[model samples]
Target: MLDFAIFAVTFVIILVGAVLYLYPCSRRASGIPGPNPADETDGNLQDIVNKGSLHEFLVGLHQEFGPVASFWFGGRPVVSLGSVETLRQHINPNRTTDSFETMLKSLLGYQSGMGGGAIETMMRKRMYESAIDTSLKKNFPLILKLVEEVVAKWESFPEGQHTPLCAHMLGLAMKTVTQLVLGLRFHDDAKVLGFRKNHDAIWSEIGKGFLDGSLEKSSSRKSQYETALSDMEAQLLSVVQEMRTQQESGTFIDSLLQSNLTERQIMEDSMVFTLAGCVITANLCIWAVHFLSTSELVQEKLYQELDQVLGSDPITLEKIPQLRYCQQVLSETVRTAKLTPLAARLQEVEGKVDQHVIPKETLVIYAMGVILQDANTWKAPYRFDPDRFEEEAAQKSFSLLGFSGKQACPELRFAYTVASILLAALVPRLRLRRLEGQVMEVKSALVATPKDDAWVRVVRRS
Candidate 1:
């Protein structure tokens, strides 16, 4: 009888401990409104997967919980700010660290040179910004030449034939970014294509793998991702070596080589910029042209503006800002397409948004998609209208969202220039038309892309 009682007591104790381990007290202690963890281990992760993406999940979350909401991402508590006002409270212009860089480093698993004193960080930032500025200034004519080649190819297409807009744009972007940022070695078609293949493999995995923990789960995927990453690193290494040997100067890589950054730092930053610059520039141009295809009036207005500004000359760096209407078209496309849906910042210290106090080290999500589409802020938020930005308030709202002025990331600023050049070149000579029965479904990842190939036919404008 004594042995039976002891065994029973031990069993009961173990059961109680297991229960507590699996399901601890709810971590929803911030007094902020959100759903509690669906599972103790993978909080809201399944929800994110089911909703198709983090951005889509945020849309539903903000709809239910208002502008500011909290959700558990695995074991971590993440607070999402979905309104322009909430974003304003969350953004600090003077902060030493860039949240985009932080998020990107975490995604790519690149850690070198991420930690430093404030002066070092600022110096690195300035170096990078200057490199991009210098690259653009020095290579503007080359960029224009690339744009003209693409336009000429499109012009060669027979009338009424549909073009694969996404594929063409991706190719153009890859060529433009690689040659300009890495070096002229990418001018070779085979080298450019090979780099792109590796890039696509690594990027595709990085987008989906980190979200669902699948990269760690699948042995095949893990092996392939590693192989692709190694190949990409090797490619970058070769470029760095060649540049060092040649004593190259005045280009993007040349600028980085001259800087005090370590070889690893140079590689990592180059990878970040190349991946970001290619994907963003491609998608922005694709979406801008796609949107224009669907709206004749908008396209005509843009053409009129381009005609009035440039007359018969190719676009130059000096004349870019003078095309105000063209800028508006690009701005509207970004807002309407929600190019980058989500961004995040780790709360370095405890922060406050409205009545809630965000705990230190919490992940704060800037739900940019939600903010861009908020009907309260944007009139006809779903419509593809460029004139909405004619108001000073709308432009101010955009600047606050980090899409304009100095708030724009270096990659985005570069993308804007590249895209503007493309639009300027193409719009004056060709009329973009959407193919019948084609619909663009958004696949929201690090960048928003069409789920299927977006096709359009172009008619020569007399």
Candidate 2:
């Protein structure tokens, strides 16, 4: 038995050696600098996984190496770009697909395909625009109604008591997005809570499954993920069935049903939007609140603007223009929090940047967090200053990579609108104060979140 075990291990090692000899794991460019080959453990993925934080690790790599550095993600050669110019060169002309979608495909065990021809892309774009219009114009009141519910809950909370802001924000986001995007209304709190539970499960699994093989490795987790997907699909299908029976028009899901796409395709698209819409928007609100709490001056100024613009009335689409200071605050929060820290693309053909060659099929990552804080572009990059965004003149000095940019995710516009509405509702009603001496730790997750509870004492404004 011992001899057989030795022979088996020797055979496996030899097989791996032969595979490496025949086809090298990574491509190397002569001028590119990266960690030595010896640093890569367990087929080039260990360095990334073993690092404490992927975002900080990549930032460190860019600081050590130059703008364009080479690394590997699980045997795939990856070149990471850490400058605005470098990223612009690559992403501007090639904004057809987003990194999240690519990551989604991989997580769902699908081949890396960005899904959409020219006509399809046009249709999808139109659909997105229409959805945004309906959401902002026709559905604005509904969203405000949801926000008011959140406000009422907060108002009822004991004074000077800390609340887990993310949970409340996530609950609000999930309901608002689902209602607006899917036209699915929750009649009771229990139903909304049920949907959110499944959403949390699938979302958590997707984040874990991207870098680790946990979904496939752990049978219980794999079953949970599958069950969540199945449950979500059933819920979506029920919505479709109800829409058909009721003959609803001008709904995003209804539009999908009208299209010549399979039920499976519709479900896939809706699920992606629902998951991303809920989580990213939740994180956005959480970070916005955190930043506002940390900067009392900004919060005061924002309140002044809100008071001046809307007066006692609720925020509307028409009034959004006059809320420039609030916009600046949110923009600064996005920049400082560095939400969606990484964007990725695949090199279709050979490319070159500054005497370095990028071979075909190489995975490229745009490190947005590091670039957003580039000292050369912004003054005191680490400081959170809403005034920094007051002028378009100042913005031109640095790239204002907002929710919609060349490399920005498309759903970001929808998420931004939702976040703006939530902020508009809350800033006027409550004052958020962070617990003293609590450190604000930005954690790297599917979306960046606070390392701790992100508790804030909510006080109703007199």
Candidate 3:
């Protein structure tokens, strides 16, 4: 017993010593924002979109602390810009690659190997971009068929049955994104069962880590995240093999897999693309419906537009141009819902954004949600107004919605088309109603999702 105590004490001391010695970077006061005693009113902001509420808090700070307000969270220095013009000028074409990739590395368990240079990096990113272009043009119709199957099956559930609308939306989005990107399906009875096992382990571990930042300290997180990556990769690899066997021209994965890309790079790019696409697209759909339910005016207007454009006809790809109002409603939802409240960049050394000096390695977060609320760029910014997207001018210049021009999300181009087509096709066939007493909330992970299931009734429309 005495010897055991001695060993235990020594082990803890040594462990503490080692963690301090090996990962000294963790000790810094990285001002990554979250809940703090100093920031209480931000609870509403945090509630609206969790994680990094500091960006909103910064709005208050900028009011109180001036144009350049620097604050601390998680030992990081976070800087927020008050001016969009200044931000756009300083913003790079590529997102400033950050240490979050370290978490990806642990999750995916890929060796830290580097082979490709500028051409290779550009090729990989552009190819990923280009393949999305191809999938949007090629694979989405197949996804629409699957969604149609899901929705057609869905309409039979009775008027008040209250099916899991959130899950179904999420599922269709996931299936669409994965199949479109990889050109494979995971709906196989056995493969789906195993894929669920793998996907759950991956999501749960990362979820806990995001809330607690325990992944940085726990070997178990490192292992679980990695194992999930490996399993996902294995699944993707098999799909890639099938794609090749089918003599498919090339897919996003097939494109990267064929090139001189490392497994880590392929897995990283694929995972990010698929995960981001699935999440943002689905949540945006859910949020859009939520908005429509709350704003009957918006819903009726959109339905009117649908009625005028493609009356009682299925939303063919050709008619997307005609469904302009529906696109505006979705756009306003992105702005009001603020699905991605903040976009971040890491700067190690002090840098100048025009005149202001942001000290080095600062985590500069664009308060995207707050920015959307600015009266200058937006009219009646707080209200859920979709009309902003109605005119020829608004439609043409609606580039601020993340996927505009160069900064536009590659997935955005495809997501709305699929979502709108689904909406136009199904809304005409079904009547949707919000289930009584179901309050919608937001949870911010990689992207924001409904806090609880968005329970709804899908009755077949006459």
Q: Lowest lDDT 10-mer window, candidate 2?
A: 1-10
| Tens digit of per-residue lDDT, candidate 2, span 91-181 | 3334444556545544454331235574665565455445545544667778889888988898899999888776677778778777766
Alpha-carbon lDDT, every model: 0.79, 0.66, 0.58
Write the candidate numbers in order of decreasing lDDT.
1, 2, 3
lDDT of 3: 0.58
Model 1 agreement with the true structure over 1-462: per-residue lDDT tens digits: 011001111121122222223223334456678999888887776787678667888899999999999987666677889999988787343366666665566556676766677788888888888888888898898899888989999999999888988888888888888888887777898988888778767766655564446779999999888998898988887777788878655568878888888778888878877877887888899999999999999989988998899999889999999999989999999999888776666666667898888776566778898999999899999999999999999999999888999988888889899999999999989999998888888766556777777899999997
TM-score, every prediction: 0.91, 0.86, 0.77
Task: Highest lDDT: give the candidate number.
Answer: 1
- How many clashes (backbone atoms < 3 Å, residues ≥3 apart in a chain or on different chains) does model 1 have? 0
Measured by TM-score, the strongest candidate is 1
The alpha-carbon lDDT assigned to residue 276 of candidate 1 equals: 75
RMSD of each: 10.2, 7.7, 8.6
lDDT tens per residue, model 3, 71-101: 5433333466554554664544334232223
For model 2, the stretches where C-alpha displacement exceeds 4 angstroms are 1-31, 39-43, 109-116, 209-214, 393-408
Local distance difference test, candidate 1: 0.79
